[model samples]
Target: MLITNQLGQVLVQHVDYRDTCLLPGGAADKGESPAHSAGRELREELGVTVPLDRCLAVDWVSPDSVSVPAATRFPGEILHVFDGGTWDDARISDIRLPRSEITAIDFAEPAQLPDLLSPPDARRALSALRARLNSAGTVVLENGCPLAPGVLDRIGVLQTDRPSYRYPWHPGPAPHDRTVTQVWGWLFAPDGRVMVLLEPDTAVDILPGGTPEEQDQGDPVATLRRETAEEAAARFTNPLLLGHVTDPASRRGYLRYAAALTEVGPAQPDPATGHTYTRILATPEQAAELFDWGPATAHQLSAVHQARRQLGLPRAARLPVTELTDPITC
Candidate 1:
């Protein structure tokens, strides 16, 4: 079974016998349906009873393709992965682990799975995540490779290595000596989903802001407003300074801010790129997932949440991130 938390982190189980973490499930008992076995495994291992109705993935594992102990004859198997739903903090805390088989549980970020799990397990978990995120129903895989790969799968989202930048939030004003080279803002919709720009070809996530131009007169916020408008057709207000990350080589600060979106117009071509960016309203967690910031994502999320509270926006519900089809101005 594949389980996730409200923050979209996958629940991985660490067994005493394996070096790599696995999704919280075991082989089905004879005559027992896969869904029933999923629920049963959760109860016996994690001591939590979660519904397993939604099948997220179906994978075929060939016996000859995998390595196992000589005593353990590996019959080829078809794996059915059911969704365990999103667990809140309170529910996560209620989980209990047995001392023997499933020794520990971790809510791992999707990008971290490559390092934390075996190659096949990592691929399977990532494919499952893409299925859930895109509302693709269920994905089919053979030997952990998706048979019909989506854009995310082809781009190698979870399989890509992430860089660990120490983007520690600074409460104080940005240093006066350092030049502000670039500005970025998290433009929060009324529902709290943040607006981000995606590259037209690669679908690479980019924060909706850019470098300060001469027309901006060295104001970082002005740069933010201009870039947001050009790249996303978005207008926002009450910009709250989140913090800045200093580039040691350049002695410059990349300013980050959060603001409430006031209006979003129809998509238009950006003058700089000559391409209309693919605008998306992603949950803060989803933004983090797409960016793959490693551990620094927590710091950025904490700062964004604080700004959200200050701006009086409600906490965003856990919904699949959506793309604006025909945007309307507010």
Candidate 2:
């Protein structure tokens, strides 16, 4: 099963017998179905109970194609990979490992999988991940690469118009009074809806983002990750630099902005922002209307829509607002 945590990290387990890590599944027992076997293995290995009916991919592996030593290899096997759903921090912490079989279990990012798992296992995990993100139904994998078209292109570029902020600012040359740099995430949910945070008092909705600090070390993506965690209480993975926006009015400096497409995670209370934000999911059009910042917000959402189009995903619909709440801070 392809089990992932809220951070979009895949669950991999280390076995004492093997040097490479493995996905949290094993061969099915006699008279057991693939779904049942997946669930049972997860319970036995990670102590987490998640449904496995959402099949993501099915790979038919040949015995000769298996990368393991011939002595340890079995006949060709048909692997049924399921979507294990996203787990929150509490659920992740609740994972109980079988010390005898699984020496260690941790969620590793997709990019890190190559080093963590065996070659075949890494390919299988990546195929599952790509399927999960892009909603490619029943992906067929040869080794680890998808046999179908449009499943491999993951990164997307989104071009935005000139940066414009809400404040009364004008463009000027260097040595300007203000040089603002902000980072934001274009986080997408499994259902293809975009996640937005609503301001409690003003009721204006915005993306999960904020200004970078001195400690950010000049990495906008890092700032995006940190600020997103603080403001929206969510974690994301495979953040590709979609693009940046710069204020034309600022001659000396500009409001340097960067965004990335992220997989949506569990939402919690923002530890840094103090105020608990109201998390909402909406389509690009609905999101454009929700933003009180006017054209700037509209442009940002447009860029996101274009990115989605580039990824071969369906356009988001004009859906009603869905709110998930948390504790409020004074």
Candidate 3:
């Protein structure tokens, strides 16, 4: 099983008998299940006992595999990689490694695995990392890439040739003239409806997002956190990069837009950006109807819905109209 910390570094162990490093897991004991064995191994090796969250990938390695030896006890092996949720710096500091079996223990970024682990072990770790970040189901890997049954489809993108529209009341210039980037979040409720912020004066509903600033540099997720807080005063969790879109007609002749799947928190007014907004939780159909920015707006909302469905989220249902209220005053 592959374990990673909050910084996205995979835990690796230096075995005294082997020249290359490996993930923190060993052969299952006589009555112990694979999952239980993983837990027990961690406790023995690192002095940490974390429940294996879920199986991320299953890889079949033959005796001829580059990482496997011909004199090995088993001619073939099926490895089940499990997700050990992020460990904070505090917990990471508490890790204690056994000296006899493990010479050293450290966290290495995914990109560094190739230099540290054997060929097959590197493939397994990379596959597990990709599955942990993108897919909800267990990914089957032949080498390092997905198997035949699993297809890697583009997550977010909607092509359009129409000239972009710029609102008269828009706070800044449009992206038609130069390249511009923006980050937004599709904040979904437990009930399945998505939250959209209503521009009180324009009577237009839009996702909680905005253009990046000098402070954001090039990090879209950081821009998302700042913009979401300013627009809706809402906190979100599990922000996954849904994908990005490109529109050639905007300010820099292109628009780089990214979205994340978010969980909405309480809404309040931002004192820094005194903009009045009405928070509305609506289904995809309602958002398509309520957004007054034209067909492009509706198309974007539909794309968001499709992304959610692709991520295995429940279908959204029509929300009550009564839930829509007047704009909140600062």
Ranking of candidates on TM-score, top first? 1, 2, 3
Q: How many residue pairs clash in each candidate?
A: 0, 6, 9
| TM-score of every candidate relative to the true structure | 0.65, 0.52, 0.49
Candidate 3 residue-wise lDDT, 1-330, digit = tens? 777664446789999998999898888889888899889888888889888869988887765665445676365577888887778788889889886888898887565688889877887787676566444468777655457332111110001111223222122234343455666567665556666776544434567777778888866667777887787766565464544444444433222232333434455665556665667666655544332333345445555666666555677655342233434221
| C-alpha lDDT (0 to 100) for residue 199 of candidate 1 | 71
lDDT by residue for model 2 (1-330), tens: 887664456788889888899988898999999999999999999888986768888887878887668988767678988998877789888988886989988887566787888777777777776566555467887766667634132221001121224332222222334354655566666556666776654444567777778788866667777888787766665554444444456632323222333434456567775676667666655454332243344455555666666554576654444554443221
Against the unseen true structure, what C-alpha lDDT does each candidate score? 0.80, 0.63, 0.61
For candidate 1, write residues 209-314 as lDDT tens digits: 9989999987788899999999888899969999887767777777899999988888999999897887777788767766644455677789999999999998
- For residue 68, model 1's alpha carbon misses the true position, in angstroms, by 16
Ranked by TM-score, the better of candidates 1 and 3 is: 1
Better of 2 and 3 by lDDT: 2
Q: By lDDT, rank the candidates, best first.
A: 1, 2, 3
Off by over 4 Å in 2: 68-72, 151-178, 181-330
> In model 3, which runs have C-alpha deviations exceeding 4 angstroms?
67-69, 143-145, 149-330
